[model samples]
Target: MSDTPQIHGRVEPGFEALREVFTTNFTDRGDIGASLAIYVDGRPVMDLWGGQADPGTGRPWTEDTVALVYSATKGVTATLVNRLVEQGTLDLLAPVADYWPDFGKAGKEHVTVTQLLSHQAGLPVPAEPLTRQELIDGTPVLDVLCRQSPLWEPGTAHGYHALTFGWLVGELVRRATGSTLGALVREQIADPLGLSLWIGLPQDRNSSVAPLINGRPDPAALDSITDPEVKQLALQVVAAVSDPDSLLSRTLSTNGALPTPEASTWNDERIWAAEQPAANGITNARALARMYAACVGEVDGVRLLSEDAVSTARAEQVQGPDEVTIGESRFGIGYQLPTHAAPLLGEGSFGHAGAGGALGFGNVTSRVGFGYVQNQLGASLIGEPRTAALIDALGGVLA
Candidate 1:
């Protein structure tokens, strides 16, 4: 309400440096509205949120304000899939056709659940581009995926599935569990843990959602960079994404199925109401951190997965030059592993970074679970600068 953003929430005694980093994000890093939470050994140590939830209306971000975390939703989806595996409802090594008979078609009879979750299934974009209406209805996209052929040999390489990963994995979960991904998320993950997380947000909670402010990179920013190597890398990324025929472009856009990443399409209530498990997860930092905390250890007598199950989910499934990103990437069953692309708290840290800057990760070695959500999307697809700074400060505290 004042000239300065009103910061809120608490931090444990040793974690004060995190608060300093969070404050500088508003003053220096251009963060409009954001929240960050951390859990150590399954208990919260830091919970912070601030800035304007709706700059247009002068509404400040509150503890309950949730933002749409793009690909960070993939980490949550992976958790559900692994939980099914832990319960024997789904098999990681079994062929996907075992659950969905239609998916075995188009030379994909041998693709396994592990391959799909790890992004090595070679089905990045559909053969036919889908319409926005088709994406909202959901069935048409699944049908298209069923008839689509792998762009590369299955399990030979990995690419970011972007949007299609949701439909591919969501349909598999539906056929195996007899419930939608969003329903399972609510029934199993959200309700039991009492978290304010959702894949398909309910209409009643729509008012609390923060609208994303696009932060697509500007070419002029390249001129301001002092380092030549960083500038060159940035230039190459710009070239790859600018080409409509490039793998990075086609994969991210799903061959034009998705609206431009900078567009306001994600802010629509209709999109929020639809189930897109790979994206469109509306949640705050507290729930994201707590969920990861439950995964690795226990939070309030609740553990999402056994140690063995967490190990299996975090185990490396693929690592190499990703065909889609045009850079090195790493993945486990469904989580992004530590790499230059997303150097999440060093080794034993596994989580996913969203399209914008939202990130969530769990570090097994340190017994830390971290989550950061923001209304203003950052330019970098991975290794978002604001989260990077917070993580750096966290490293200092941990050391």
Candidate 2:
């Protein structure tokens, strides 16, 4: 009923400044609707949300409002796979083709699970265009992916697999667990922890999600990259993204009719209901933060992973210029390592950022888990300044 954005939720005594950062996001940073949550030493220290859930309908953002956290979903998916590794069912160093022989075709025989998880498999996009229906079903897309050739030799270079990461990781999960990534996540992580996150969202829960509003990057968005070689690559990627016939466009816009990279695919119900581990998972800051918290330590008597598993998953597998984004990338298995895009966490923090500003991460050494979700999208390589500010504010408390 109120026209003005109202901040709602609790912040423990030590984390008071986080509340100020959340409020400033609405008042000064143009945040339309967002939530920020943090867990430290196995308990929640902050849980907050404000602004409108749907700007078009003027629906207020609430404690229950969830949103599609594009690539941040990777952190969850990675946890699913890493669990298999911990159980010794899947070996990180083993060839991916060993588990799924079909994946070995077309010069991909030696691609290891580590290479796939670390984004060094050089399969950033599919060899051919696919439809949303294929993405929803996933089997047909997996068939195509198995038979496709790597755009580059495995391990020689690394690039963000983007859309392909879900299929690659999902198929590996199915081979190891006899269950889909979504099903495993629910049974092993979400259900035990009682977290409100979904890899494959149920149709009935659709209305609970906030609608995503797309944003455009300014023409000079890439001007901040100072490295000359990386800058040149960034310009090339930007140009390819704009050209519909380029690999970047064809890969991003599986449906040729839709605009590449900027398509409103996540806004579609079909996307939300499907399991795309690299791109589509519906959740809020609380679920994300709590899930990450469980990864590193006990949260309410539940710990999703052992300390050794967490160490292996967060250990930096690769760091260098990414062939796709033409930006410096750091990856540890399926999680994005601390880099310029998400450098606010401590030295060893690891998590994933969505295409927009959404981010979810946990610092192992610091015993901190943080999650931020926003519907108003921004095209920042690392994360939105608003989310970064919250991370900065968090540091003062942790210090």
Candidate 3:
């Protein structure tokens, strides 16, 4: 593919420099393909791509090539939860049991939607044996979650929910609206706003998506943790992640009809599909940046959320060593807000870094929404080289 921009959009002062980050590493490090976009104040400024849509066939990455965002889709899902709050159907502060009564069992009656959103409901790293098949069908997995006991006391400490974040939040949406989270997202968030994102994709659109290649694993992360149980859990997460056929793998693989992991398949026909709102958002850089830009700009003639709401989304909701993330991580109600006290994620920015290397976040201070997705997944929790370059260039752009 030519170095010409992959998607059309207005370019901001620092955007071309940001593109260089991808171009340099993308070419030097060797990339199958990548697309990037940047939006500021509701207008797209930069969009570009290089490499192959199908490296296997030497198919060029085109103007519309979209890649699987691994876990970057979580940002989109969190946006829906905010919209639910905006529409008044779901209260972020309400108890989980309020929507699904059975969820109240096992000392979890007090866990609020806000708490769950912040990964403080204490059920991270589920204790029960959950099969990929059961999780593929959300209802069964939820049945187990409802009965499962908390690992830590509710609100006592927070741990990253990893895969369970979607189930916990998605289940609440299902009970509150009587529709799957995917359906509600289509109806309320994407369609209305004209965003190309999807929580669960349909089966027909599979061919357009680029296959995900999880990045090289860091040997240090493997060697550091000595706990047998924690290591086992991490191992399970890693193994499930490598195969597109795993339950969560489906969203990244073929069988694109549903966003659940079990739908993933390694075959060619299974390669592309819709953006799974939780972790399988299939989007181009242009769309990714613009989506967040809308949050900072006028969103379909409406602001994504009022300044107050955005403030709430970005403010520190849970602090201290995260129970799940269990490091310097900080979380806002439904977003990741790193504190000045701990800035591993990003400072004054809000969003999530997808598993592997995909990342999307909005800088409230700069009113910037940036997204970086790559076929080469990185092990860094927040981002890899592509994203780091983008951020550095963005800083220079601002400077």
Best by TM-score: 1
Q: CA lDDT of each candidate? A: 0.87, 0.83, 0.65
Alpha-carbon lDDT of model 1: 0.87
Candidate 3: residue 114 lDDT (0-100): 88
TM-score of each: 0.96, 0.92, 0.81
Q: Put down candidate 2 lDDT per residue, 347-398, tens digits, no spaces.
A: 6798888877788998898888899998888765434777889888998888
Q: Is candidate 1 or candidate 3 better by TM-score?
A: 1
Candidate 1 Cα misplacement greater than 4 A, ranges: 1-4, 216-232
Give the least accurate 10-residue stretch of model 1, judged by summed lDDT: 254-263
lDDT of candidate 3 over 1-399, digit per residue (tens): 334323323456646776666677665444557777766666666766767676677767776666677567777777778877877888877898999898999889999988898878876544455554555556665777788888788888877676677777888888899887778767765676666566665676566666766455566775576776556655765675566555334323322333322323312332333222456567666666766776666744756666777777777777766544334567786677755332422575787776556677777677777776666555532225556666677777776
Q: 2 or 3: which has the higher lDDT?
A: 2
Evaluation by lDDT, superior candidate among 1 and 2: 1
Worst 10 residues of 2 by lDDT: 254-263
Q: What is the lDDT of residue 173 in candidate 1?
A: 99
Q: Candidate 2 regions off by >4 Å?
A: 1-4, 216-237, 245-247, 254-263, 381-383
Q: Every model's Cα RMSD, please?
A: 1.9, 2.7, 5.9
Best by lDDT: 1
